[model samples]
Target: MPMPATALQEQLITAVRQNDAAAITRLLAEGADANAPDGRGFTPLVLAAYDDHLEATRALLAGGADPNRPVGGGNTVLMGVAFKGHTGMAQLLLDHGAELNARNGEGSTALMFAVLFGRHEFLDLLLAAGADATLRDNKGQSARDLARQKGNDHALTVLPE
Candidate 1:
């Protein structure tokens, strides 16, 4: 008999957390729903990309994971990748249709997160991918403003005056 769908999904979540791409792929083939939120309300793609599991992220995307799915505080996988300075993961998320300006509950965009966390390296990639630099958080802080506030000199240098 086939493995129960719920069991496969649970195992798929575990594989993503473990960064086991092969297991993730196999579980998806066995009818795991990559978009299904686990008990924690996080989808497989969100968990994989947020944790910087590149291969696991790829497998989940291949299995039809929605790159735009919101994780906590309405933050998407791209936001997490941005904060962590993972260019590869950010690029993959972008290629998979992650929204550039998607905001979290605080109305902060991925660019803002990058600047806030001093992940200045991600600035160019995010801009090149079409992130709106003018977007402000709920506090009305633009990427540049956040950079200044956070004392991110590197980010300030990259951002325009």
Candidate 2:
């Protein structure tokens, strides 16, 4: 049988949910697995990214969480950062080796998410970081296609046609 979650693991998950950087630090120091996923496969890093908790995301990354790990729905932490328009968090993940072209379950890249969500500020950052503008999602929609569909003409100005 799979072993149950340790007390520290539970607390670490809780700390991440609460955005308690201090508690997360203590838990990591006390030997919690920074990469441990909760019931839904959400690691602390994923949770932090989803919530736009920059400091907590940084701490988890520092603690060795995999930036590429899919946190359910085939979404990476970087995708969450893009969805939330957290350019700094996305930059931090890139610096730590996040795959700029990593696709989620739907084959949608973080660049696609940025365009789909109308996060104009993230477009340049993602492009400069090397996201593939020509990449297609499961629906065969490129980031530019999504932008066109969303009527984000400003994004069209920069994304490939």
Give the winner by TM-score. Answer: 1
- Computed on alpha carbons, the lDDT of every model, listed in order, comes to 0.88, 0.86
lDDT per residue (tens digit) for residues 75-161 in model 2? 888898888999888888999999999998899999988888989889889998778999999989899989989998878999876
Off by over 4 Å in 2: 1-5
> What value does the lDDT take at residue 69 in candidate 1?
80
What tens-digit string does per-residue lDDT give for candidate 1 at 40-114? 888988788878999999999988998888877998888888878898899888888889999999999989988
- Ten residues in sequence with the least summed lDDT for candidate 2: 1-10
- Number of backbone-clashing residue pairs for each candidate, in the order shown: 0, 0
Residue 63 CA displacement from its true place in model 1, Å = 0.9
Error of 2 at 67 (Å): 0.7
RMSD of each: 1.4, 2.9
Error (Å) of candidate 2 at residue 10 is 1.7
The alpha-carbon lDDT assigned to residue 133 of candidate 2 equals: 98
